[model samples]
Target: MSVKKISRHSPPNCGARAASASVLALMALLGAAAQAADTYNSDRPGGADHRLLSRYQGSLLYMYGEEALGKADMLFDDKGKPVMRPVEGRISNRMYWGPKKKSPLEVYRNYRHALETAGFKTIYACETKQCEAGAVQDAVQDLPRKVVWKDSDIFVENTFNSANQPGFHYYSGRRTGPDGDTYVSVALAGGYEDEPVFGRVRQFVQIVEPATAELGKVSVDAKAIGGALKRDGRIALYGVKFDTGQAVLRPESTAQLAEMAGALKAAPALKVYIVGHTDNQGELQGNSTLSQKRADAVVAALSSKYGIAPARLLGRGVANLAPLASNDSEAGRAQNRRVELVVR
Candidate 1:
């Protein structure tokens, strides 16, 4: 996090204010272009950035959600300003950073550049002044996330979360397809200064068509789990069902969870690691953390919901570091994202 700077040098006598403004603008642009210590291509929470876009360089993917058929809030910088336009279809919610100089224009532009490169044609966009006056900020200081677990991604989340919340602005995208013209909307919340600013915040809400999951065709039983773990020392089980961006176990997973508890009960001396996996299709931002949380959730369910001994189940995540199949296809990616009972 950066603190507000106070220059001690005396002001220049000629065109001093103009020089200051010019310098500030230059700094804002430079900050937008500044790369973090490592390259971050965090396009996650689902299958490789469904909109075909990656996050802005140096930005971490804080939170994302998707639904096959849903609705998104559409914002326009037009006469109506920040007023909402709700559109229905396959909905996805993605909130990203506004590591700002307080002047959101610089960071906002760079973020948009990343989106535009993915072939979306911008139809509407705006900065603070362009929005309607008296529009309210989001309900809270920080946008709520689905799960708030401490992961390596938390450090970067802390960095962006510290910035002051600013006014709402927007940009929309339209792409022509054989089906029709699909729209994409991005709303930016930006401020206007540099001396005391450190973050830029924006959100994108989209609706994409829903699709079916071919997973969960078979449920693993206690016999199968024990046999596999005994023979191979581990078993990749897709019986556990987790939604695209969800960390909690679904009610439908009760059958498999019961079977797991059964296997544990049958073998008193056995202990296993409930390892979680997510396919690395687009980005690696919070995949490991997300995977860890999912694994932990499974462990919690087995212990509290069922009667598995807590000490016997250790949970961990391996991100996309290990993949059982290629990420080039949805089928292969599904196979890659699974939970395994690895004997300890």
Candidate 2:
């Protein structure tokens, strides 16, 4: 066919091209929004942004990937009846499942699969709320490949998910351990007693753990030491035996030591003073000696076993001075025997 001659300055085809490009841009924006709603920042703890988890107001939460399954908060319907609705991502109980009547392992597996399909590689999960120390350790040991645990506390692990987005999930129930390691768990969310409002497809996206520089691990007991380490320059660690009064280091102390060592190593400039205490059973002088001995023992272990410097280790004896529990009873006496660390 003979080609028709085209004028060099004819109305450009730019109109159609511009319209196509606009459509493409709109699609891209929409796609990005959808993705944002789907992805998890494993480092973000709660699957949202750092600011939201930093202050953490309200009881609303939005579940992505495994979190979306069968979770919602109860709201009174227009008919004065209770209904479940989507909880805001930052608010607590947003995806409250109330209580699980089924097996926690089942729930964990289901969530794990759902998360994996969404391409979230850092999957943190728990089986129950009251888990045994051994159970939690086992769960941690059994974590899927490539998932790094920030702490051994199952409950805190859940909160870690709430604070970060790398495919974090939690389960409610109890875990029992036979003296392997004391498993401390923090229930950050879940148990809202509602059904799933989102569709069956759980969204998952890659997320970096919240920068260790901010919104770090969370602690529920006492001073919330985990957050202290991440947000503040100092974290005070006190070691105590179970049932109190016993100056001997308890098994739980192992976990704390591990954490303290790691914190010191991570921040080379950090220094810590390890203090030991004894109950009031013995004479003041004897208790002081015992406390000093215990403190020295800790220093020796840290320096020799863990490679912490003697200069970095300061041992103090607080003899029956700091009592967390009443010393009137044997239980309280047990509480008085402890070792603590003051960050310098």
lDDT of 1 at 339: 89
Question: Over the stretch 17-126, how does candidate 2's per-residue lDDT look in tens digits?
Answer: 89999999999999987665443211224533222122122212333222211222212233432222322111121222212233334434554454345343321334
Best by lDDT: 1
Error of 1 at 42 (Å): 51
RMSD per prediction, one decimal? 18.2, 18.3
lDDT of 1 by residue, 185-222 (tens): 65555522332223444543343432225677578999
lDDT of 2 at 333: 57
**lDDT values, one for every candidate:** 0.64, 0.43
Best-matching candidate per TM-score: 1
TM-score (C-alpha, index-matched) for candidate 1: 0.39
